[model samples]
Target: MGRTTIGKSNAKIILIGEHSVVFGQPAIALPLPSVTTTVVMSQTTHGQTLSSRYFDGPIVQMGQNLAGVAALIQALLTRFDAQDTFFHIAITSDLPAERGMGSSAAVAVAITRAMYAYFQRPLTRDLLLATVDIAEKITHGNPSGLDAATASSDVPIWFVPHQETLQIPFTLQGYLVIADSGIKGQTGRAVAAVARRKTAFAQETNAQISRLGQLSTAARQALATPDLPQLGHILNDAQQQLAGLGVSSTELNHLTQVALTAGAFGAKLTGGGMGGCLIALCPDRVTTEHVKNSLLAAGATDTWTEAFNLEEEHQ
Candidate 1:
């Protein structure tokens, strides 16, 4: 038996550039500490196993949805020369699954960090990201690695797949209202849907992708300039493109519209769309509350607020 080890990671949100990132487009994302995942690894009296709100079983018996996790555990054991060891990997997370909050990536990151700690081995940032991605590729086919990167970082970033992630300074004066639409955002299905669209309607789909990419770039500038209205417009435009790509669901659109009608400067689906949370950029605290109330009344299961400041303040 060995000492227990714990590893944890914060959730993340893509501010702009979602599906297009897979096609080499740039994206902006930031870590959200409001939600997180914690992994605990310890010597188990029983054989190798997993424990979480989602499942509890032998590692080998993990369902198809958790194949990435099982693969990560095996890979870690093999890499750290602990294949002969038997332990239980327990995951606790506040992040809502399939809400485009980087739950899978955060869990993978926590697991990798915990396993490395268990082995008393040094884990470099480069190795940590690569290790987490081994599972991300399985959970999210053709992932841009943005979620993994943001989950591990302390600041916002301008991310491009296969390129260096550039940290950005963010300190806007307002509130970012995030609301769950009471549905799972099927990222795999959304991604595959976009992929099919890209193949069948290359010109049209690529145009939408290109537009989203451009909006991400413009969004960066808007944030730098502290242009809240411009940022809101950019978000609205990006939502239109995402909807055009058929990733946005009726729930997502309705919630965003509700936020807008309730006096939000702008709002849009934040994650994989189809069925996930929407983010509303409110002009002030009062407007933020209005947006949140509207979302909840419109069937949002939950909501959180991240204030736009140099220091991340949660409400």
Candidate 2:
């Protein structure tokens, strides 16, 4: 029997820029350490098998939904020259799937790291990202690569597809409340809808995309000075642009409104929208609690709070 190897990755949320990032626009993504995915690997007498909440069986015969992971395992084995070896791969995650929390990317990153650890090999950041991108492609056709990049990183990231990822430095002084709407986000469908709209209204859609890109750029500057109000304003502007793109749903809008009414500095729908989570900026802990309670009262399925400080996050 071989020694067990483990790898872990945290989920992520898009603070600004979502569908627009697909068209060469910058976007910001924050790592969510509060949620995570873990992969464990161990040698086995039988062929390669997978154990997870979604499915459990030989890798070769996994369902279509798991094909990306199956291909990832195959690619890793080939990269390590261990195609003939046998192992059992087990996956566990706290991040909810289909909630626009980068669950798929987290899983891919964790599995890639575990495979490298199992082979007793060093994994570089570049290599890890490239490997994860392969899996991401299979899962999300023509992904922006933001999810994979953010999932593999700890700090907040500024990403533009096919460009070098920049780590934005900032001190967080307030609280962020994330509320899930209990509706699964249809990212593919949303992406398609945006594409159709872009084609139909080329000039208008391009203008909105350009505006979102600008907001992200400004938000990055605001983060440097740690301006919570400015950041909140940027979030609000981005949410309006997203709604114009037709990705925002009634539930998401309701949650954002509830948070804002409850004294949030700013509120917006995060991620792919159409059915996902909304994030609210609170000036302090007290406001965070108040806004959280309000969101629940307004029908939020779940709410989680994240407090950010430079000292704590950097350390």
Best model per TM-score: 2
lDDT (C-alpha) at residue 119 in model 1:
91
Q: Model 1, 1-315: lDDT tens per residue?
A: 568999999988888998898788989997887677999999877699899998998999999999999999999999987888989889999888878898899999999999999899999988999999889999877677778888987778798778769878875677888899999888789989999999999999999999999999999988888899999999999988999999999989899999999999888888787898889999888898989998999999999887766354577
For residues 188-298, what per-residue lDDT tens digits would candidate 2 score against the true structure?
Answer: 889899999999999999999999999999988887788999999999999899999999999998889889899998898888888988899888877988999999988
Query: What TM-score does structure 1 among the candidates reach?
Result: 0.88
Q: For candidate 1, which ten residues in a row score worst on lDDT?
A: 306-315
Which regions of candidate 1 are displaced past 4 Å? 44-46, 188-206, 310-313
Task: Check candidate 1 and list the clashing pairs.
Answer: none
- Candidate 2 — what's its lDDT? 0.87
Candidate-wise lDDT, in order? 0.88, 0.87
Deviation of model 2 at 14, angstroms: 0.9
What is residue 73's positional error in candidate 2, in angstroms?
A: 0.7
